[model samples]
Target: MHNNEQLPNQPTGCGQFDPRFLAQIRRNLFSEIGANNAQGLSKNLRQQLEGLPRNVRKEVVEEIGDQCAALFYACESGNVETVDYLVKVCGASIEQRGISMCSMVHEEDWYFCTPLGGACAAERLPVVKYLLELGAAVNGSSECGSTPLHIACGVSRIDIVEYLVEHGANVRQRNHSGETCLMFAVLSESLCGYLISQGVDVKARDLYGRTALHYAIEGGNSQTVQLLLEHGADPFAETRYGNDPLQTACLTGALSIAHYFIIRYNYTAERLADTLELLGTTMIDTSNTQAVMYWRLANQLRWAVPRYIQKRPEILPRSAFENRVEFSTGADLDAIAVDEDAIRYQGLIILERILGIGHEHTIQVMTDVGYQYEHSVQRDSRKCMDMWLLALQMRVQKHSILHYKTCTTARSIVRLMENVLHRNVTQNDPNTLRFEDVFAMFQLLVSNILETRHLLSVQPISRVQQDNHDNTVRCLTHLIYLLLSTAGNQTERRLVESSVRDLLRHDIRCVRTNESLLHLSVSRLKMLESEYVVDKSGTVGIFPNVNVTNLLLECGADVDAFDRTKSTPLHTACLPLNHDREVVRALVEHGAHLDRPNLYGDSPASLLAGNLANDVVLGKHISLKCICANTVVGSGIPYQGIVHRMLEGFIRAHEPV
Candidate 1:
């Protein structure tokens, strides 16, 4: 091990500290504090440590700072009594710092801090004063460089903020992110006013180059924005992303703040129109149906503005959708307000145009819009598929073929295709799911699988990479099932066959289950069953599709390959839940040996016999080669020495259960 490399399970230079004991102490502290028995708590804790050797006890006491310390817990719980006991008797350092383990309102909300910072975070002003009196550093920072004043202001603890500042906490201190107390205090109007009065810079930019006004706008607090602006916060101050207060308000869907900016800041009529359009588009990305509200507001504001300032263009630029909708001046903006479909697509188009087609945000909004279309009252599969196709094209270009985003989008499309095909078949509609789209999606999946295998050949793969490869494989299988379901014409059938052949030519196996595509198609694995039931489309038990089974075999899939359970495709097909006779017949026709046993010593023929209660005979006319192999195995011959090296394993596979 290199000197610089640390074991993940062990902290630096503290091998003697046992994390289990620390966890036990946490549990005991909570229970004991709840019982209000501070004396018993201290006594029991000391006894737990007394069992260890003196050196280990000292190490545990000192190393508590490296973990969640008792002092921080006491501070957070406002248990001043425990704070004194731990520091005075238990040898805990007064300045001990660690992750605060109290007041866990959220799982990920805990933070690393000293005792004073912990108290301030929990808003326990009494505990803050007690820690300060105990000589806790008033200006002590947490692991993130956040001082007590920073925490106090962030959570709007104005009283605590005043006390900390009076106790000599630096009001101008910047954290590791270059954020001052003023930046964190922007959410509180009184706190912001006080911090400004104390000489904190109101216009100070953080490491992200965002001013206090920008933070206030993003926080969606008008009063805080008002206070910061009155204190000289620049409304035109831009962040590193070039987003000012108005743009921040638009992005965050803060319509009231945007309105307030126009009322107080006197934004131009053109600027208000642009902001309203941006706001409407943002709402479309988030709220599918409520996006028209902003369009109506924009029209109302347009009419409210003075007639002289209404020098708008005859027609705004068309949105980037296929429909290319354009809004004319004045009353024409109301058209989009009434058309929900236009509102949905126009929002997606505006986002893609602003964020770039290949940006992750664009991809996400596109996928979200597609989901809304799919689940709408009419189940608009056409619009849904269109959005997903656009998203898939961008994802394939922007991300790796096996990236989770690309794989996820492709899987969603395949599942949608399944639902569409089932609906079409039930409704007797021949033109519901287009054959060209299925073929195109199938070709994309095959290309991704082949590319993933190529990458695997050139580089060692990680677990994440292997899982992604398996996911892509599953996507390909579901897609092929769709193709097989709708192979109505000779051209479509040929496309499906060619794609399956291209996919099966690679030596791909599901990395998690170690099952080949043939095994997966035949067995209907447990994970795949629940995954197939995406919605209440009522297309259950569609897997083990006989056409998909035969297609894989026709594409030259290995029929006798062993999965992780040492079961061949035949053994899997013979399982009770997956006893599809057609699948079994297909496998047998593909030269799957019926008498081959799995690792559990159960042959396909025997398992099938057990399942059928001798109702039908299978593999009755055994070949002479199989008879010889069975005779050697049944007679307990040492075939490993007598038979050819390749034939030895094959002969052993036929041994009796």
Candidate 2:
């Protein structure tokens, strides 16, 4: 046992004061506080010699800081009355954090200060509500970027989630990992649905580039995948490493999900090849004693073989190598035969390749084998199994192994990429090929993308090389342009919208990169729209494709960006007869400056505030767009339902009804 003096940052050498005596004093103080013995505590505090030494008393007072120790205990115990008295009578600050003298990391959010956060951690929702009403920051984030709402949602405290949301906790707020409350809610489909309905980006990627769909797929929750898809989650959304939902579903053996994508989309063969490539090898090791132990289990036994062979060196003698030898029924020889029977198995290669299970899972199988061998090796009762060594008397056939030709399919995909992606795609009219078909071709090409990208480092881009780059970019840019143009055609729009986003995924998901295609698309859009500055494309064109706009914001776009005319995207959306609620909501959710003035000293908010139709058109029972547009964050008035009612009245008076 060590003294408190040995502990890092623990104080020591207080005259004759002992550590054991100090521990007893701490225990007594907490016990009294826990029992709410205020009179006993006051008496103990007055009796300095009996309670604590004069020097220790100064140390205790200095360590905890001015008399707010009671507040931490009260908050931990959910003692609201004591908290009220401490804050009001003693002038204790609710925001006051107890600074630790120790060198360890502090619980910046969960404790120290923040009575509201403390009460929430204890599931004291009523106390949480009370503290919030008394002016606790609803959006106060903890050390790990977890807000009260983040904690509540994580613990499935829906009541707390509701309260925080209603009090204006930002639902779009990300944690330290760039995960949203909605990402946490994926484990609960109902919560996920509600968050999606609130306009949280279904397209949002976490730090790992996994969308909500990726999480749902990885979790094997098919129903949750359906829910995210319904909310416009892109099926082809890729991680930074390029594993999309299909690759993830196949890897996890989510057959229902893999089948769902296969039925809807094409190129299942190419996708499987990519999965096999990711696994590093196409075949598992096969041996004769397969029924007893698989390749994975046998691989672990290989290490023990040398030790076992050393014990029975006669099995590897030079005399046996020189002359034809016959083994006698010796105990060592029998033990070797038994050991061999216990661990030798063949590969189940082709099926494993198609199923997508690999070394990662077999590593766990090793643990399972060890546990079973330890617990059941001594069992006398025989199992329904045949040992190849014992049953056949060592006469089992030693067959040659074969492997699946995954690379054959991979080569075919490469040829297909060279065929499709080598030509100028935009040279032909976008209407010549359906955007959906073009995007499917793009998915296949990129899915089977050759290591030829590595060649760029080896040599300069030639005319042929530049053609390859131009063709892919042309395919992507044209797909985006066509998708934008075909917004009036409902079925085509639905079919190609996701593909357009898929093409833009690289630009959208990256925080910093060359958006050559995206920048070109935006410039082309402005060039295409010479007469009209705004279109009523709610989720798409009003302010650039909503997907492109969102990707820009995620990649750090300036919200108050002005064109040569000093008009922001907000100004474009608010132009007469061109207003879109979804576009405005999207902009505001990403922290777009509401009051950033363009040229001529006019803010976008002022433009909307002047327009009665903007409010009326955005009119609904607590319309989010109205809240988003009107909720000037620093104005002190967050979104309120009453604000909607007031606007609805203004709309009714202006309308014929």
**TM-scores across all candidates?**
0.61, 0.35
Per-residue lDDT tens digits of candidate 2, residues 1-657? 111122123344546656555554444444544665433243443343244455555344223423335455555566566556445444445554432111111122232335555565666686677677768788776545656666665555667777888899888998766767776666667777777766788888888787878877876778888888877899998787456888778556565787687677776333433343222221221222332222223223333344421111232222201222222223323333334322211111222233322233332232223223223555211110111011111111110000111222122222222222333345353213234433444454343223233443444333334334334443344444444443446776655555544444443211122234433333323322111112222113322455655554554555545454455566565555555555566666655545545556565566677776654322332345435443444354444454578754433222111
Instruction: Give candidate 2 regions above 4 Å deviation.
Output: 1-77, 82-93, 96-115, 250-264, 273-657
Residue 395 lDDT in candidate 2: 13
The numbered model that scores best in TM-score is: 1
True lDDT of residue 574, candidate 2: 57
RMSD of 2: 26.4
Candidate 1 backbone collisions, by pair: none
Instruction: Please list the residue runs of candidate 1 whose C-alpha ends up more than 4 Å from where it truly belongs after superposition.
Output: 1-249, 256-273, 284-322, 401-405, 425-431, 453-468, 525-534, 613-616, 619-623, 626-642, 652-657
- Candidate 1, 198-302: lDDT as tens digits: 998988988878887877787788998888888788988877756788877877788899878877777777677667767888777567445666666665776
